[model samples]
Structure formats: C-alpha cells, structure tokens
Target: MNTILKQFLLVSSIYLFTPTVDAYSLNDSLTKGTAALSSATQVKGEAQQLVGQLQSQLGVSQAQAVGGTGAMLQLAKNQLGANTMSTLSGNATGLSSLLGGSSGLSKNLLSNISSMSGVQSAFSALGMDPAMIQQFLPIVLGFFGEQGVGSTLLGQLQSLWTPAK
Candidate 1:
C-alpha cells in the first residue's frame, strides 16, 4: 500500500509540474491576442459612434439610443431567424453588449415579434415615441450595414420595417 501510494504521488507531481505543450509560442499567442483586442476595440468604438449619432440626430437620451438599438436589433433577430442573428452577433462585436443590457421588453421580443402591436409595445416600453421608431430604425440599421452586417440582412430588415408606401 505504501509503495502504491508512493507511485501515485510521483505520477501526480510529474503531471502537475510539467510544462504544457501549446500549439503556438508565447509571442504568437500575444500577437494574436493583441490583434483580437484591437479589432474588438475598433468595433466598440464604431458602435459608440453610432450611438452618439443616434442621440445627436434624434434628440434622444443615451438610454433611449441604447434601448432603441436593442429593440430594433431584437425585432430583426425575431424576423431573420437565429442563425442569421447569431452571425450578426458574432461579427458585430459590440452588438451583443447592446442587446444584453436592454430593457425587459426588448429581451422578451427576442423570442417572438410576429405582430405590429408587439413591435410597437417593445419600442414604447423603451419610452420611445411611435413616430420616432420610423426614423430610428433606418439609422440604427444603416450603421450596421456600414459596419459590414451584410446587404442581404439589411434588405430583409428594410422590407419588414418599411411601410407599403
């Protein structure tokens, strides 16, 4: 039993103390991490710029800008199916943060937004005027479009949100 215990401790210590063989070198890992962080910072900066534009152009508060963006994105996600939404979320770095801190109404709409009334309710819950939604949708979505969110996705959103005029 003592010999068995000794063998176990020896194996355990060897496993614990050995250096891991990583696929990439330390310098390579640092370079990749730095690049990823830079990309994320750039995406976040662009998102902030859009939010600032929304606030300035629409005369809305910061909360309104964030909430409105969330509401609009949630509505689009509801319409476009999860796969497309996931792609958008993955590619658009700050998008997840914007969607995450939204009001309950916006988060609830993530699951279902089949009716116009439902859409209006979500926006209204964010304290947005119904009239403002018409103006707000285009700006938020257009920013995403400029950020390379894909023309196809933007087209679908435009079709859904735009009235039959």
Candidate 2:
C-alpha cells in the first residue's frame, strides 16, 4: 500500500508539472495572423486611394470607380494561381464590396474581361467610355506598382492593357 501510494503521488506530480506544449506554437500562429491582417489593411488603404483617384480623374461616380476597379482586379485574380489569388484577395478589404456583393453581376462583369479587349468590353458594358479604358489601366497598374506587387503579377496585369486601336 505504501509503494502504491508513492507511485501514485509521483505520477500526479509529473502530470501536474508538465509544461503546456501548445502555448508557444499557438502564440506564434497568432503573431503571424496579426501581421498578415496588418498588411491587408495597408493594401486596402492604397486601393481606396486609387479608387478616389479614378473618381476624381474620370469625373465618374464613386460606384463606377469602385465597380470598375473591382472588375479589373478580378481580371488579374483570374490570371493568378489559387494561392496568389487568395493572398491578393485576402489582403484587400475593399474587394468584397466592390465585387458586387455575392450577386451575379460581378461574376458576369468579370466573365468577359479576360484581356485588353475584354477590359474595354467590360467597361463599356458598365457604361464607361471605351476611351477611358487606356487611361484607367495605367492608373491601376501604377497603384499596384506602388503597392510593391512583384514583377510577375504586375506583368500579368500590364498585359491586359492593349491601347485602343
């Protein structure tokens, strides 16, 4: 009975004293998540500024700028791989609302816009002038360049800007 009691006490002490193994890993994950979210917020701010630039430059309504910009971003997203798209989308807060809010309009607008001509078509379909498409492409690409998008993705986006014939 004495030996059994001693063994039980030792086992209980060991169990009680064991350190929590998950605490460090969980904290690390949280730190990474917070950093990622912070980056997304910064990118979102830059995107909003670009939208403002579009509105002011084109004399279009806010809705037009946001929607058009969203469509353009969707075009780029379509060209990227799944992981890149996820990172891009996750980092932009304005994307969700500008993409037409879960309705089919956004998807439909993006469906036809696979290239430069498609960009003009999509904008024209949205009631924007075809002439303005060239102007908007540089603005969008310039904004992304400022935001530090890599050459690969930026190049992909730039390819969508064939000037009006």
Candidate 3:
C-alpha cells in the first residue's frame, strides 16, 4: 500500500508539472495586415454573397435594409480590401485616403443605402444634408464600435417618432 501510494503521487506530480506545449506567437505582418484583410475580405465577400442570395431568395432588401448588417459587411469588405491592409498599415498616404472622403462610403454605408432606395429616400426625407454626412460616416461608424449598427436603426426610429408639441 505504501509503495503504491508513492508511485501514484510520483505519477500525479509528473503529470501536473509537465512542461506545457510551446505555442507559436500568431504575430506577423501578413497575419496582422494581409491575413486580417483577407479574412475581412472573405467575410465581406461572403456577406455580400449572402445578401445577394437573400435578396434573390426574398426579392427584397427590406428586412436587411431596416437593420443593414449584410450590407455593412460587404462594405467593410470593400474598404478594407484584402491587399490594402498591407499598404495601409505602414503608409500614411493609404491611411489618409482611408480617412479622406465620400469615396470611402462606397464600401459599407453606400452599399447599405443602395440595398434599399426607400431607406435612402427616408434618410433624405429626414433632411440629411447628404453632402456633409457622406464624408464623415465612417468616423461616426467608428464612434458606434464593432456592430456599426444601432445608430442607424436609432436614426430610423427617431424619424418614426412624432415631434412633441
């Protein structure tokens, strides 16, 4: 009994103190930039594809138009192109262009807008000075954090709310 207990403790301690498996650092330029971009791109492409599929299936972008996730996903895919991340990471010029203007909207927001013209019309009706809001949408999107939604639906809700006397 004493010998068996000793052997069990020895084996238990060895198992408990065994060296952990060495894990490779997942840090690298391609991973941080290109790989991230590729993933974002693939995600966006898949979203766009899904949106396309859903649109074809449903014959309406209304449900998504109301919330706009699929559209936004495709847009992010476009702005953060799989290849562009490699350049944008180090180049101020790429960074500046990303921060620049309306052209940037071609990605997420624009596609969202395009998904349903009625949505665009509704926003236009709310008296959005398109010329202004168009340029800074991304900054605003950034302010909202990862989901990049809530505010848009909030805006829609606000539009629906009746004015107080």
* TM-score of every prediction relative to native: 0.60, 0.58, 0.18
lDDT by residue for model 3 (1-165), tens: 699999999999998886555422322321233222222332222233433443454343423322233223233334445353233223222222222112333233334332334333333432333232232233323322332335554354233221223
**lDDT of model 1 at position 32:** 45
Model 2's number of clashes is: 0
Task: Please provide, for model 1 over 20-128, each residue's C-alpha lDDT reduced to its tens digit, 9 standing for 90 to 100.
Answer: 7673475455344323322322225356777788989999866666655655666677777678667776656667545543334334433355544555655565567
Q: What pairs collide in candidate 2?
A: none
Flag the better candidate by lDDT, 2 or 3: 2
lDDT of 2 at 30: 41
Error of 1 at 4 (Å): 99
Q: Give the poorly placed runs of model 3, Cα more than 4 Å off.
A: 1-44, 61-67, 70-103, 107-165
Model 2 vs. true fold: TM: 0.58
The local distance difference test score of each candidate is: 0.62, 0.61, 0.34
Question: What is candidate 2's local distance difference test score?
Answer: 0.61
Score residue 27 of candidate 1 by CA lDDT: 43
